[model samples]
Target: MEIDQPYGTPERDVMCVMVCGKLVDIDLHGRRYDGLVGLIRAGGTDMSEAMVAASAAWEYARYDSDQTMPGFRAAACQQGRGL
Candidate 1:
């Protein structure tokens, strides 16, 4: 990802997408926006269909990428650390 203002905050703009060293898709989210709240709002959903749509989009995007199935106890090891 290209850093437009890396020193100010670690907020990232999806500059590009790559799978196994090849760019496959493009993102249209614009730059120059406050990111923390926007990031949360990106995943923020209330309706069931909204959640399904988001999950489907993620699965389609990462369909060709490496996949991992997390174990049941994986959550207790790291709570919100990766978040």
Candidate 2:
């Protein structure tokens, strides 16, 4: 798994999570948090759940000293990419 920090503005930060050459999640944080929350409230929990989990996992892995997101790495490896 890889956490990609693409170009973003002060109002929005784009975080992309890729596993086995496939994009599994994309998280937009910072000023867009409220909008995302509102979307979740108006939509449903299913999408929110996945995004939240991905965001949390990204945070944990990004901050950890080892800099490794084990879950995503394992999944990516199993899917045939060494990442």
Candidate 3:
């Protein structure tokens, strides 16, 4: 995981986590869901490892991690060009 301080939006310069090349929004303390609806873009690397880490928040997390809130799994991740 890497912090992208310049993850820009019309509102402001949102910070996001570069997880296996996928962009997951994060907060000052850690994982964030401030304005997130879902992943607005896709990734090149296998994003499962990064997905698990990104969805670590207790309320939104589960055994499958990706099944709970982030809402896209391994197969879906690679489908077409976006998720």
Candidate 4:
């Protein structure tokens, strides 16, 4: 999902959150993508926890949350690489 950036493309920086030596989450906030980047950047100890928080937003939030979004519940998160 990489794309040309306004300021020019930068090398992708792949960051991950490891839980017990396993990658539980990943962050590509500075990369050339959308959606999950904002969630990750919202701030957390790691991407995995951030992702969980973001996903849970749908349930815990009153409105304008991922849960309220039409398709967020079924949205596919990339939980790969032993996460």
Candidate 5:
């Protein structure tokens, strides 16, 4: 599973899920923070689970990259601070 931004447009966020090296699902949210709404609109029944999975996948991908953006990392880290 991976998050992909459209080529030449970093604003569009899309999540791609692969199973056995084959593409299974693709979730697209107009903005990164709109993931839950997007998933719901796409027929997801478990919003909380979807959000958690997306967040974990994003964090894992971000930390695995050497050229990660500090702002993105900070924003993601701050999301559940009060919870």
Candidate 6:
């Protein structure tokens, strides 16, 4: 996965599915969201479907992720800071 620092929010990172990798704009159906709240709103009636969609988007982004990018860190790295 990758860390996506949103424009004008250096202190915060958007970890949503569609923003999982570098080429996030291609992830699918979530660029309109702001965060969990937005996603929940997008869910309207069924939150599960929204979650499934988010996961799919994450998987899609991860599938073509370029590990060399500065924000592209392995899931394993999230387990250990290594510092």
TM-score of each: 0.19, 0.21, 0.21, 0.19, 0.21, 0.16
Winner on TM-score (3 vs 4): 3
Instruction: Write down the lDDT of every candidate, Cα atoms only.
Output: 0.26, 0.33, 0.34, 0.33, 0.35, 0.30
| Cα distance off (Å), candidate 5, residue 8 | 28
- How big is the positional error of residue 54 in model 6, measured in Å on the Cα after superposition? 0.3
Model 2 has an lDDT value of: 0.33
- Model 2 TM-score, 2 decimals: 0.21
Best by lDDT: 5
Question: Residue 18 of model 1: what lDDT?
Answer: 11
User: Residue 43 lDDT in model 4?
Assistant: 36
What is the clash count of model 6?
0
lDDT of 1: 0.26
Better of 1 and 3 by lDDT: 3
Query: What is the C-alpha local distance difference test score of candidate 5?
Result: 0.35
Query: Candidate 2 at residue 58, lDDT?
Result: 31
Residue-level lDDT of model 1, residues 1-83, one tens digit each, is: 22453321221312111123343333334454444211212223222122223221122233223232132124423453211
Winner by lDDT between candidate 5 and candidate 1? 5
Looking at model 4, the pairs that clash are 58-67
TM-score result, candidate 1? 0.19
